[model samples]
Target: MPLAALVLLLLTGTLVPINRKFRETPGGIPVFVASNGLHTDVVVPTQDARTGLDWRPLLTASGQPARPAAYPFVAFGWGNAGFYRSSRGGHTPGVGTTLRAALPSPTLLHVSWCAGPPQPGTRVAALRISAAQYEALAATIRASFQADSVGRFVPAVMLGYTAQDHFFEARGRYHVLRTCNDWTNRILRRAGLRAALKAPLAGSVLYQVQHVPKTRNH
Candidate 1:
């Protein structure tokens, strides 16, 4: 029965949308969804004051000093910590770790400081959503971070990293049925954007975002 359910999920997860409504935002806030072939990340402008996210603590918690100009945007990605951390530093995790991550396991939030927006033809989708939509997306991202009693982001020290990015403890568990792309899709949906209902692959999310009309009148 479990195998049958898993097959059903994988089959239904790839179903394409039909007659999906694509709305336009009047001078909406620009955001980007990027994919590195395997995983996806949502990038938002750091200078957006309305987000109410203090970069100081995030930067300090990252344990990597960064300049404002050097990182105009912050990219957030969520996934299983075991697979995510092992994939870092050109190290591949063992099959046991991968299997555990593919099942139910602890998750982590990966943050990367970006200099500019995602490049063209690089599996990146850009969207201009309303301020309300952006606010919802930002709130969803912020809520993913696990905070201490004082409300500071709690860093996950089990992972080793050499890049400007950092990882923090995140809410929920990661599994094959509910992967990082699903989290990204959920966030986009929260912002009133069209996305796959259950996208476990990065390509699935990008495919749905590509269907949006480039230009639409209010």
Candidate 2:
């Protein structure tokens, strides 16, 4: 019975479009969703002068320098900490680690410095949303960061690095029902953009974003 139910959930989640309206934000802020085949990230401007979200503090806390002038965008992603911290040295986690992550485990927040907006391709999708939507999304992302009493982001033990990317402690639990892709989808929804209701896989989330018109007008 459990196996059957699991299969049903996957089937339904994979086939259905969570939000098919393709609604456009009225004068929305431009944001980008980036994917590297297996994982996805939400990219936003480093400092929204209007919203007053200076991401420099978060970057500094993670031991990353402030965003360079050429790279004005910051990318954020959430995932199981064990999978992220242990999947180093080209070593895949065993069944134990995988099961722990699949059943509500601690999570990590990944922040990266981006050169600019995501380009339309199999690996990236872009969307433009209103300032209101952007604020809500920013709040949601901010709430995910685990901070100290002084409100500085708590850096996670070093797992690995990729160019100008770093990871930090993140709030919330990660499970099969709320994977990294699901996190991205939720952030997009907070920004009033169309996204899959339950995107367990990166491809599932990217598939929905890919269908939307890539032009900024939308």
Candidate 3:
């Protein structure tokens, strides 16, 4: 049955990762995976130490209440465009909007700034990866952005949930299979980090990080 197949897939996805040997290199770039109970985001610095990929140029901070660029950490999240833009956690989205997200739909990149690292708890986990790995991860995030004619990430018209954060057009489909957590896991895999093979849920990815090779050097 379809329900049985989906259950099996979720079980396999939760239990399996692309690489069991993925190790968190000693003295690697520090990053954190932040989850808001249901959704996940990859948190990095304004400028990566290895690649020097500055997001200051692309993100909007003009006429804002806070200076996002000055923040110590930046978090990147991807999800359904309409859901993300209109969502304030104030109320659940309408039936139509929720149904649309169940299908292949437009996605948006949610870029938010954090003053400090996410506390290592159930909702937040930290990882240390090599410079090469960090750069690769950053590259993947960059590629996820929907580029313009000149290959630039345009800021979405909708105002951000916070003064320091803003939304931008992103390339991907937000559906049952390709959820926000799945995108985060894919980025980790591309960067050679410990990531679930199919992480459609935030808990799936968070649980796998606990099994990654840890180093005291971090």
- Least accurate stretch of 10 residues (summed lDDT) in model 2? 18-27
Q: Candidate 3's residue-wise lDDT over 41-138, tens digit each?
A: 99988777567777666564332344544587889999998787557756566888888888899988888888787888888889888888888898
For residue 209, model 1's alpha carbon misses the true position, in angstroms, by 0.8
- My TM-score estimates for the predictions, one after another, are 0.87, 0.85, 0.91
Give stretches of model 2 more than 4 Å off.
25-27, 61-64, 89-96, 213-218
Worst 10 residues of 3 by lDDT: 60-69
Model 2 TM-score relative to the real fold: 0.85
Q: What is the lDDT of residue 124 in candidate 1?
A: 95
**Best of the two (1, 3) by TM-score:** 3
Clashing pairs for model 1 are none
Worst 10 residues of 1 by lDDT: 10-19
The TM-score, computed over Cα atoms with residue i paired to residue i, of candidate 1 is 0.87
Better of 1 and 3 by lDDT: 3
State how far residue 173 of model 3 sits from its true place (Å).
1.4
Best by TM-score: 3
Clashing pairs in 3: none
Model 3 score (lDDT): 0.82
- Per-residue C-alpha lDDT of model 2 across residues 75-129, encoded as one tens digit per residue: 9999998877767765776788888887888999998887777777778877776
Best model number under lDDT: 3
